[model samples]
Target: MDQYSVPAGPAAGEFRDRSSKFVAALYHVQDEAAALDAVAEQARIHNRCNHHCYAYRLGPGPDRWRANDDGEPSGTAGKPILGQIDKAGLSDILIVVSRYFGGTKLGTSGLINAYREAARLALEEVTVTQQLLLTGVRLAFGYALMTPVMSALSQLGLEMADQAFGERAEVLLELPESTASATVRELQAAIAGVYVEEVGDDFEVEGLTVLVTPTGD
Candidate 1:
């Protein structure tokens, strides 16, 4: 997926029922490592809390996530949190709910509702925005063509993906797949057909199919 929504910044919310408190914090994470780190930090912060149940969506896809119920039944805490996140149509984010038992055992259903509400509340306070995914293109061109080639990229607001200089300099760049056809046309018109091609496998982002071509035959 090219674009998806993530938390604008960090946000927090809570839900209380029968004195049991479920506090949730939201964060934007790029990968599993960051998601786990956020969970660890929450655990550290709420060291004395009963459980640190969490759910994270790691990629543009829904299958790239895990829900940990912590110690509240098998599917009580984590699944509800994850369900809430998915319901909000968000990914690449983590919602960690720290629970403090108030001497009242919120049964399976209670725990589920509490966690879901907590996560939903936290998400409601966040600012959602779209993020783009970019892929690399290894563009090899004659040194002489660098001027117009660079100018074309500059005008399109495209950025270099790599930095390597040589006689026939190779410049890697990234662009959204949605503009691939137009971009290819622009580059072709500027440099002729001598160089420029897709380099890697086609990928998806922002609900667009993207492919890269290399200059080499």
Candidate 2:
């Protein structure tokens, strides 16, 4: 399956009318069940609203889902919100549009337009990036080699996963599958063959690597 990723911040919008207020909630989610649960929770929190409608996509999963309208007309609230998410080519996301009733009632079309516009406006403020499958690596080396190694890493414009000091200081690094070999070669040369390095097979969504023990072949 393709990797999933999302912006770190919450996306929200508030729209108003003479008799109603609509607040759209957009969040980046990782799993289908979690996204649906979040939507349900929001609905409960805003239970006093006239309607709580939501939509979500879990990519190719059996639960790739979209729901809406709640107690309103079919395809009015939930479908439009989900449409907005699909239009943005986003998955693992849940959006709930909560409506507090005003004296006047909006027709089905009006509800659809309001929900769609709210979602679009909220998403406009988000900055999205592609998700990648990453593997982690940890390297142990002497203190004397730290400066040169760091300099080499800087020259290569590589991001360090982490650095920690102990009996033997360790440097954690993450590399994309495509660049792993090149990174290993560069590090090996920088330390002048004095470093102990290990690579793991695990994958991560973020660009940062979380260190794990390397597998013994």
Candidate 3:
């Protein structure tokens, strides 16, 4: 998948059933590690709560994800939270629902509805945004080819993440995955003596490190 939906930022939701309070907190996370960290932090914040259930989806396909029921019954908390996330077609996000029991027990269906509703409410409060998968590219070329290389990238509507000027010129680019290959080919055809290679998004260009952020089209 080239793009997917995610929460623009953090949001909170609340649900009450039979005096029990369910607080849902949503966060935008890039990977599983961040997602887990969010969950852990929520647990610490709501240390008095009885349960800290959570669900997270990551990446384009979002196949790498998990749901935790915490101390709640199997599938009572986590599954419903995950269901709400999938219903919204969202990824790279985490939702944790902390429950404060009020001397009452909610059955299986009651737990599911409470969790689902909490998650839904949290999602409703968030502004959904799209995340585009991008490919990082490093270009090295001679001074003579700098103008053409830069002009080619500009014509393609691509922006440089980082650039360095020395004996040779080096530039870092983050291209949309859909057009990365085509953009590279166009640059090669337009400029001579230019070296181009695909790199990971985290790859840093020494001497001139710049942050490359993914933007939706």
- Best-performing candidate as measured by TM-score: 3
- Stretches off by above 4 angstroms in model 1 are 147-172, 193-217
lDDT of 3 by residue, 22-63 (tens): 999999998888998999899999999979999998878747
Residue 114, model 2: Cα distance from true site in angstroms: 0.9
Predictions: Cα RMSD each: 6.9, 7.8, 5.9
Q: Residues 58-127, candidate 1, lDDT per residue (tens digit)?
A: 7665578989987779999898999999899988889999998899878878988999999999999989
- Looking at model 3, which ten-residue stretch has the lowest summed lDDT? 203-212
Q: lDDT scores for all predictions?
A: 0.77, 0.69, 0.82
Per-residue alpha-carbon lDDT of candidate 2 for residues 1-217, written as tens digits (9 for 90 to 100) = 3344454556887777666888888887767677777778778888888677788776434366767677888888888887888788776677888889887878877887888888887787776765654556676666676776677678667787787887656787777755566566555554443332433233221222224443211
Error of 3 at 95 (Å): 0.4
Positional deviation of 115 in candidate 1, in angstroms? Answer: 0.5
Per-model tally of clashing residue pairs: 12, 2, 0
Off by over 4 Å in 3: 154-157, 193-217
Native-to-model Cα distance after best TM-score fit, residue 22 in candidate 2, in Å: 1.1
